[model samples]
Target: MSLRRLLLVAIALTFSFLSSFVLATPLHIIAAENFYADVAKQVGGEYVSVSSILSNPDDNPHLFEASPTIAKSIAQAKIAIYSGIGYDSWMSKLLAGHSHLTIIDVASLIGRQDGDNPHIWYDPHTMLTFALAIKQQLIRLDPAHQASYQHNWQQFVASMHPILTDIDSLRQRYAGTEVTATEPVFGYMFAELGFKVRNLGFQMAVMNDTEPSISQMKGLHNDLIEHKVAFLLYNLQVSDPMTEQLKTLAQTHKVAIVGATETMPKGIHYQQWLKQELDAVQKVLKK
Candidate 1:
C-alpha cells in the first residue's frame, strides 16, 4: 500500500477504537443512600459508576448538609436515585439546575406520600421495587447491557428469598410482640415481621427532632417499666442524650434493645446488611 493509504488506514482504526471506548464508558449514577447505591451497583454491574452521598454509617443522615462537592456530583450524574419522602430533601435543592439527570425518587415510585415512614429501605418490598426501577433506568441508559441488568436484578430477588423466609420465621415466633422505638427507623421492618409498634407519638417526635408530649413520654416510660414492650428499637445513627437515657431505662428494665442505622455500613452488601439487622432482631426475640 502507498504511504498515504497506510496513514488513512491508521486514522480509521484509531477512530474505530475511540468509538468503542466511548460506547464502553461507564454510566455515572448518584444515590442519596448507600443502600440505593449498592442496589445501583448490583443492577448496573460493570457498566456503571455509582456515588452515594448519605452513605457514612457513622454520621446522622438527618443532619446531612449540602455541599458544593455533592452539588457538583448531582450536576454531572447521568442518573440520581433518592428516597424522596422528605428523607433527602437536600437532593432536590441540589438537583434544581440539573434537569438532565434521570431522577429516580423511590418514594414517588411507591406512591409514598409525605408523612409516611421515611425509612422505605427497611421495607423489603420497597427494595425489590427499587431494584426493578433501577434496572429499568439502567436499561434506558445502556440498552446494550439490558440482559446483564435483568440478570442482576433477578439475582437480587433470589437473594431476598432467604430474608423473606427469616421474616416468616420471626413472624411465626414473635408476631404481635410489642416494640417501641426512639424513632421509626425500623418501623416498616417491624411491621413486616408482624411486631406491633407502641408509642408512635414518641417515635415521631424523636424523628422530627421535637419534644414528645408529657403524656407521650409518660406512656413510654410506663410501658418500659411495666414490660408492656418486648423490645426497644433504637436509632443508632441519631441517638442523643435523650435517646441514651431511654436506652438506659430499657436496659435497666431488662427489655431487649436492637439498634437500627440509616445507612449501609462499609463493605457490606445490601442483602447482608438487612440480614444482619433481622438476625439481631431474632436474637433479641430469642432472649
Candidate 2:
C-alpha cells in the first residue's frame, strides 16, 4: 500500500474508535446561575453538558424575566440547577412543567429557606456540599463514568483548600472588623470572614428593588464618610441611582472598595475566582 493510503486508513480507524467510545451524547444540564454551571462542569467533566441562563455578570439577577425560549431550554434539559428561596424565582416558574427533569435547588440543599440570604454559593461549605451532590448526580446519570466523576470530585475538593485557608487567615486577622456595602451580594463571604456588616435596612431595600428610607441612606453615608467599616463591598452586578451614589461616596471618602459580582464571570474556573476575590479582600484590608 502507498504511504499516504496507509496514513489515511490509520486515521479513519482512530476516528471510528473515538466515536464509539462516546456513542452516548453528554447529559444536558441547565443551570439558573453561572456559578452552579461552573461547578457542574468541574464535577461532571465531559459526561454532562451545562448551560447557564444567568451567565451575564453585569445584569442584576433579581430583574431577570423568563422567556418562552428559556422555557423550551428548561424543558429539553435532563437536569436543571438553580438557587431557590426567592433568589432565582423565575427559574422555578419556568421549570414548573418539567417534572421529570432532575432538579437541584442549591439553597434548599444546605437547609436555606425562604427569607434567608439567597447567595449561598459565597460560602465555601455550600459549594463543597453542592460539589458532592452534583458528583453523586453525575454518577447516577452515567454510571459508566463513575470512576472519572469520583476522581474529578476529589480534585475539586482538594482545590478548595486554598480558598478555605485564605478565609481562615482573614478571619483570624480581621475578625469583628466592621464593613458595609451597597448590597449584600457578598454577605455570606463577609460573615465567613467574621465581619460586622452594617446597613441591613439599606441592603434589604436594594435587594427587594425598593427605595431605601432616608434614614437607611444616611446611615450608610455616615459609615462611608466616617470609615466605620474596614471596607465597602460594591455590588457591580446591580446598580441604581442610590447604589451608584453610595459607590461614589465610598470613592470620595477613600474607603477601601471591594467589588463583587452576583454570578461567576466568564473565562474563570470556580476555585480560582473565589480565591482571587478573597485575595482582593486581604489586599484592601492590609492597607
Please give the clash total of every predicted structure, in order. 0, 0
What TM-score against the true fold does each predicted structure earn?
Answer: 0.92, 0.90
Best by lDDT: 1
Q: What's model 1's overall lDDT?
A: 0.89
lDDT of 2 by residue, 1-287 (tens): 99999999999999998898667668889999888999889989988888989888876788888778878878768889998899888987888868878999999899999988788999989999999999998888789999999999999999999999999999999999999988878999999999999998898888888888999989999999998988889877766677678778988999988888778889998888898899888999899
- Cα lDDT tens digits, model 1, 153-204, are 8999999999999999999988999989888889889899998999999989
As a TM-score, model 2 comes out at 0.90
Native-referenced Cα lDDT, model 2: 0.88
Highest-TM-score candidate:
1
